[model samples]
Target chain A: MPIIINLDVMMAKRKMSLNELSEKVGITLSNLSILKTGKAKAIRFSTLESICEVLDCQPGDLLEFHNKE
Target chain B: MKTQTILNIMFFLAWFVFIALLIKAGTILTTFSISWFNDMAAEKMYFDLDLSMYKSYSPIHYSLIVINKVILITAQAYVALLMTELLKGFNLKNPFNHLTVRLMEKICFSILVIWVMSIIHNAHLKALEKSVGLSAEYLDGSYLLWSALVYVLAQVFKRGVEIQTENQYTI
Candidate 1:
């Protein structure tokens, strides 16, 4: 998909470990890992909201779109 | 008993019965007994469809009968096996997996094979009617419709598996 998850980059910039983000976002580590690894098909608005609130970042920082060749 | 156990027993019994019939067919081909068919016809059961119409039987005619019976029994066995596989899938934690969809596809393929075999058998019966005065006319349409329905069901199951994967991956 053109839409890519950049969750790992945001987490790195914020110096947030996966376990810490999972605890703060109230989601399982596996689910958070799925998103961070760009394996997630979609992000729920509530989950995105929780992640943004925890990391203090915009949705754009966690998601990116690059045109596929 | 749970439904899965019941289904398992039923499928096992069905396979056993079909295998028995296959053995009986083999014996019939080897013995070539008219009285066996006559006894079945006398019972007026499923075998009485067009048995009365055959006044005499040649070796070739008996061979045709044997072949047609084998085809029908093979189709039934195929269906029974597919049903067992489907029941096994239903017994799983995730019944709507890719393997389930593949089993459904195999079912559809088996139905199609049965339909084609039925058509060929019907044509052979017509030929026998012209050559040997055997008045059997078996033209079943349900198998074609059934195959189409199963094909659609396989597609639905395929979509279900895809959605399940998407759901798992969604965060």
Candidate 2:
């Protein structure tokens, strides 16, 4: 719950839509949506690598840890 | 030979056992009900155990013995029904889920209750043995071990559900 997904921010910086990134990364729209909405529990390294390569962003840019308390 | 075929076979088998248990429970119930009005009805078939001696001993004890058998058999039948339900909702692709885990827990608790009830049934019969010339043969106490095994499996299934959920969320 403390982890935040910055997928949307990176996608916006890259000026890419969810469908475009999904097609490029070979991931499904629903999965990308989960990552975009921060609903994903964990991302596989292979998937993260694909997303990074597609969006031209580091994994750190897509994920962040924020303390709630 | 496929897993789905095996599961389908098990599902049908569970239903078969459930119906068989239901019929047995119903027969014993009918026998007990009839015995209430007619003493001769006590000497009947399908009870697995001949408990008619208690009928001459006392009406209350007779009723207790027959009723206990009914409850235990019905409970066993209920477990079979749950097993059928569990297999009914099971999906091979998504075997780990909340519903499956919940059903496993329910089965575990039901078996535990049966085990506890069996122990009590045996103890009560043991106390009455000398007075009624009861046989040493009693309900098997192995259900305790069975319930324990089911409880452990349910815990493992709960963990499987968590892992599957995490895997589904993984992108």
Candidate 3:
């Protein structure tokens, strides 16, 4: 859970809606929603690559780590 | 296709066993009640398992044995019914799910209950054998092991469900 998906931020910066990003990345809207909401257990490398290509960003731009008590 | 056919056959067999066990329990219980009015009814009970001699020796033990047998048969019948439900929901595509897991647990628990009841019934018979002229021949020691195996399988199936869910959610 510490590794967070900042998919919404990347999508916003790229002026891309969730639906647009999902279409460009060839992923389902529900799956994109899951990633955006940080509910997915894992993101495949191919899927990440697709998302990064669509959003014009690196994996680091869509992911973050934080230590919390 | 072969697996589906086999599962269907097993499902039918489970229903058969369930009905058979229910009829057996019903017949024994009816005979038990009738014996109070017609003592000879106990002499020609279902399964040809005459209890007249045991009744002559001790009516309490006779009733106890009959009741125990009826309960054991009924519980086993319940397990069969649970098995039918389990097989009914058998999804070869998504075999590991919540319903199957719960039904498998129920089957295991019911079998365990039957096993414990059989143990007690056999011990009771053993204690009364010297006077009754009948040794305990009904104790199937395999029920305990079978129940344990089912319980383990249920747990494994539970793990399978977890892993499958995780996989499904791993988009």
Using DockQ as the measure, the top candidate is 2
For candidate 3 chain B, which ten residues in a row score worst on lDDT? B130-139
DockQ, 0 to 1 scale, candidate 2:
0.91
Where does candidate 1 clash, by residue pair?
Answer: none
Model 1 lDDT per residue over B1-171, tens place: 476688788778867766776675555444445535554431232443344344246546645665676777667677776776677557445657878888889989988988888888888888888897766757675899999999999999899889989988878
lDDT for each residue of candidate 2 in A7-69, tens digit (9 for 90 to 100): 888988999998898899998999889888888998899999998899888889988999998
lDDT of each: 0.75, 0.86, 0.89
**TM-score for the B chain of model 2:** 0.93
Q: Which stretches of candidate 3 lie over 4 Å from their true place?
A: B130-134
- Sorting all predicted structures by lDDT, with the top scorer first, yields 3, 2, 1
Candidate topping TM-score: 3
Q: List clashing residue pairs in candidate 2.
A: none
Q: Where does candidate 2 stray beyond 4 Å?
A: B45-48
Instruction: Please give, as one word, the docking class of candidate 3.
Output: high
Writing each residue's lDDT as its tens digit, candidate 3 over B74-169 gives: 999999999999999999999999999999999999999999999999889888886657655566868989999999999999999999988987
For candidate 2, the per-residue lDDT at B30 reads 85
